[model samples]
Target: MIPQKLEVLEQTEHKLVLVIEGISLEMINALRRIMLTEVPVMAIDEVIILKNDSPLYDEIISHRLGLIPLKTDLDVYKLPQECECGGFGCPLCQVSLTCEVSNATNAPLMIYSRDLKSNDPKINPVDPNIPIVKIDKNDKVIIEAYAILGLAKEHAKWQAVSNVAYRHYPLVEFDESSLKNPELNSLIVKMCPEKLFTMSNNNTLKLKDDYWRYCTLCMSCKNNSEGKITVSPKEDVYIFSIESDGVLEFKALLGQLFKIFNEKIDEFITNLEDLEIES
Candidate 1:
């Protein structure tokens, strides 16, 4: 039951770094893959362009709209396929966004995400300033789009997170006594691309105090040090980092990941139980 533990190494508005222990490489990778594909986020899937006066075509405008990230409320919406409306347009599974812009000024006007108003106040573009298109004076555009909760498996625009990755925690081994030449020590310290190593006041190589937090395990130091340094991955430990595009909060993303993970496990167990096997 106590198979894994996790600690946050760094946290920011758009990025998170974590140290995970007691988990196998396979398990950690599974989590990453799920976050990249299975978690659902709201994205524009259907568009109705009633009028267009801009230089961009209707299809191009639709594509641009699909890529805009929208704020998601996991509790308030359901995936279309899983909705009680049987994937039909319904309040529970879809939100409508409309954009109607007319350039009255003499100068060219740029259409922004803020120009599109959503029927539901809870779901709108994450960034108000994302440019959709530019229209000349007297140009008018009218559009209606539908946003629905979907998985990245269907389209990348629905992906919940970006830069989802995990790497093994690095372990560096070396002895100062093995290398007598100061020149070699200097080379070893300079070879690390992450700058994880530094020369101490006594002319010995020293790893940074929080090297584990930044080490990429590139093995640059080990390769150039002529066997004086050893760099390898520590077993059963990993560093995981994920970046968000602000569509969904990190908390919501992780919550959705576990919910989907558990459902898969339960399904696998039930299928195995119902299967007949020859002894």
Candidate 2:
């Protein structure tokens, strides 16, 4: 098979969209699964509650902490299971975060993930606004959290990508000559939920390309058009989109995913060679 061609349509720190050609759906789905489940990220793994005067139990607070997305540096850290410390605990595998709060005001004070102090400067909560718990006036809360490098397969908190999906590119065909009738044009425009159809100055139906991506393939336009319009999917090309969970940049996540893919391919080739040698 020929190699697939990947053309990046849009990219940002948190989101990416690409057009991939010459690839099968099964191969693309495997990459999506790996990005969602195999990507390594940092998240709170252990909690040591020193004090708790709030209504929430220690386990509840710990769960909240674990869900918070932490900044990850793959180059500087190692997965806990792979660390040389034997998984007991080490600076290379874990980070310590401490949160201490004593509400002195009359109003209820909200504790947020930003309140947690991390021993490592590089690993911290991605969103400071994530509320951990609410404490009434004169209440106190203290806790120690241990953040660790892990894979998303172990827990959702470690998932690097928030979403990964792909779909066939949309193809819309409209017979403008047949849509010259004002009544038919009005009907077509009215049937489109996305408002994709509009009337041109020449009194013919016009389709907007901007709304094509949001097409639901409901066949309303095709059904109402009476052979004036048709919609289909471009089977050979796919529109792919990915969303990051803030632990790693979208580009960084893609780089790591490609690295993993190459490694897996090499390992498969090596195993095949070994099997042939044995035969």
lDDT of each: 0.91, 0.87
Residue-pair clashes per prediction, in order, are 0, 0
Model 2 stretches astray by more than 4 angstroms: 1-8, 11-13, 274-279
Q: State which candidate has the highest TM-score.
A: 1
- Structural similarity to truth (TM-score) of each candidate: 0.96, 0.90
lDDT of 2 at 173: 92
Residue 207 Cα positional deviation in candidate 1, in Å, after optimal superposition: 1.5
lDDT string for model 2 (184-250, tens) is 7888889889888889778888888665577767778899888657788867677889988689987
Please give the range of 10 consecutive residues that has the lowest summed lDDT in model 1. 1-10
Pick the lDDT winner: 1
TM-score of 2: 0.90
Scored by Cα lDDT, where does model 1 land? 0.91
